[model samples]
Target: MIKKAVIGVLCAGIALGIGIVIGHFGISSGPSWLKDVAKDVDESFIERFMAEVNTIQIQENLRELTDVPHMATTAGDEKTVQTMLRRWLDDDDGLDDAWREEYNVYLSFPDANNPNKVTVVDAANVVKHSIREKEKPYTDDQRDPDVVQPYAAYSPAGHVKGKLVYANQGKPSDYEELSKKVNLTGTIAITRYGGAGRGAKAINAAPYGVAGVLVYTDPQDINDGFMSDTNETYPHSWYLPPSGVERGSFNRDFGDLLTPYLAAKEETYRIPPENIVGIPPIPIQPIGFEDAYVLICALDGDAAPFAWQGAFNCTYNLGGPGFKPTSAFSNSDVKMDIYNQEVIKNSANVMGIIRGSVEPDRYVIYGNHRDSWVHGAIDPSSGTSVMLEITRVLGRMVKQGIWRPRRSIIFGSWGAEEFGLIGSAEYTEVISCSSFSLTLHGCSYTLEKQMFRLNKTY
Candidate 1:
């Protein structure tokens, strides 16, 4: 009885002590913030953050970034790279650390001197009609010498002339259906965008013996039948202009095209040129729907399947080997003179870090690309503008000794994203992936790789 009474008294005393401590420190919950903590930070933090974000700064950044065409590995891309480095490495307000990592990666570009041409030509080599190499000079943006002509990146440079055929979407199934009706051999396929990937449009045609491919963005798909009316397009509304040519990478693979499984570096194992696959075997080019309409209306054959019909008012047809007898271009063959060349160039990824106050080793990656098909104002420069603005505000806070993140924040201004996501791919291959806790991207480029990770082929 004495032992029990003494034990109960001691337990009561211990409980009372714990209660006093709880009252004094308010220490009931999960583990505390595991560092030299800021005081009562939650109350005003969000308000302060919102106030710090400046719209003018973001706009200025956007304008500067979109001033030129910064295709991956080009001079404009280097300018953007330097811009990122300068912003991130500012002494007064900057990241805790900043650096650039470079990799030599393979890329393809159309010749600036001899532009790729898609034209209607007679057997006598007289040109009946030619699609313009570029969009109508809507503004100085289109006329700039740096403006890359509309050509499928990674398409082989060559000249191929064949009878024109209307192949809808260019999917394997689409081709399979078309093959049942006519021979696809030695045909120049004119396919509209929207069913399969840009590369698959040409890659799917190779098995059926297609000679060349011309891809176009249709009015129904992109403009909602807004052709012949200037009032319904850009500057007037959100519709695409009739001359809008959607250029894109025509490759089924991502990462460095040269180094598949390895990090692209000064010295890495590059697959032999002959070994590369998942790209167009024949030359491919992109044209505006205006050009598409001209070529498509000329074709004469069985009326195209109802499923194959697009927004164009004319009765669509599979080719009867050439143009209709009524058409001015009746005997003219469609020729693609493409001069795309593959080059190995250096691309750099600009990286910045904010060391975590608590767990410096762990990271939360925030990234945006710096390269684009054109100026990329919407796709990346806008996203880049926001990214830079975030870093500026956060960096200012860190510099002023006001706040620090719990997990290290790494900002990536990725390069060569326009060319198969080479920069980020090499970064992942070189870095320790186990250290990454999360990654936030402004655009999605990791879809196929993710698909492959799950054992599903892209």
Candidate 2:
């Protein structure tokens, strides 16, 4: 009986040894074997694709795209679109397809023919300040003479002169207070940027019968460092310097002004002129605070409400026709004269598509406005660089057979966003228009989720 038991134990030990050897050698068969094979393929492709995204590429792309100013509707803007197209074509990630979608849309632009002028004069009619906000230097390569001046896009074209009235921020409530203090009719409104949209300031003043508007960046609104004499500017800190003027659109009504619910195409019907809530009739100009101070210091009336006071050394006041003299304008009239020329032209929108494997009808859209007020390094170029980089990575994954997204991805390089979202709004209008909807099968799109997908592990 003992001999038989010992043999049994030896057989059990041999079986365990064989099992260990098989497992170590990966000799297992069936579904587990297939899973191991699949996992190895995924790991190799994942690492390779991730390695494709790097700082060197990102830096190179940013510098290349931002090397020139590409404001919407300019020759530079078209060139920028072509450059982006070239990059997409040059990509080696084995994309399924690439192309551009062109739309003929109306864009508002400023040129030599259609221009704006803002002049500050004394009672003598001598020009005290004649400089309107022009494109100034931010970097060695950013200055472009053809770049549009600091006029509010879509502002009415007219020449009007009136007494300079210091209206704090030119918001609705500020005007409400001014109406209580003095008559606001026919006076030019002087306001600093803040408290409201720049366009809203102009719109609010129209009801008060103001002749024109002046928008500026007050030192009080800027940071302590920007207002200080000693501080680093751009390429060092993000703080805005004194000379820097913030440029933006003030199209009051929602969506595209030219083509609201319908696309801005020759074939589409447009709303009547009276029905159209388009450009404000008042002439509006945006100036740097340096120019603004020359006028703000000349203001005189009752002491401005405590909240109305700015960082300026002089006390803020609501100046109008009857105000008493306190400064340079004490003995003379402070007047503002403005002229604006509004032009309309055709602009384009560039788009790229990556079809999905499962749900091609649905989409994951990524967009960045490629147009800029200047070089747009911070506004849109930075975001454009990121979008391009993402395309490369996803392309690699698709080529390596590692990822197959459930929804299609569409990359849009929008134009004219700085001009009150013209490019995007027009695009939306085309999508919903009866004639245009036939192509998209009446597809409905929504901004379901938004994410800032960039951050360093460090």
TM-score of each: 0.87, 0.80
Q: How far off is residue 99 in model 2, in Å?
A: 2.8
User: How accurate locally is residue 213 in candidate 2, as Cα lDDT from 0 to 100?
Assistant: 86
Model 2 worst lDDT run, 10 consecutive residues: 442-451
Which is the leading candidate under TM-score?
1
Where in model 2 is the C-alpha error above 4 Å?
A: 1-50, 113-115, 135-139, 228-236, 272-275, 320-326, 331-339, 432-458
Counted clashes in each candidate structure: 0, 0
Best by lDDT: 1
RMSD from true fold, candidate 2: 8.2
Q: For candidate 2, lDDT tens digit of each residue in 264-376?
A: 76666656544656466687878776666667766777777888787777777778552346554454443434444444466677766676664566666677778888777
State the lDDT at 353 in candidate 1: 86
Report the C-alpha displacement of residue 418, candidate 2, in angstroms.
Answer: 0.8
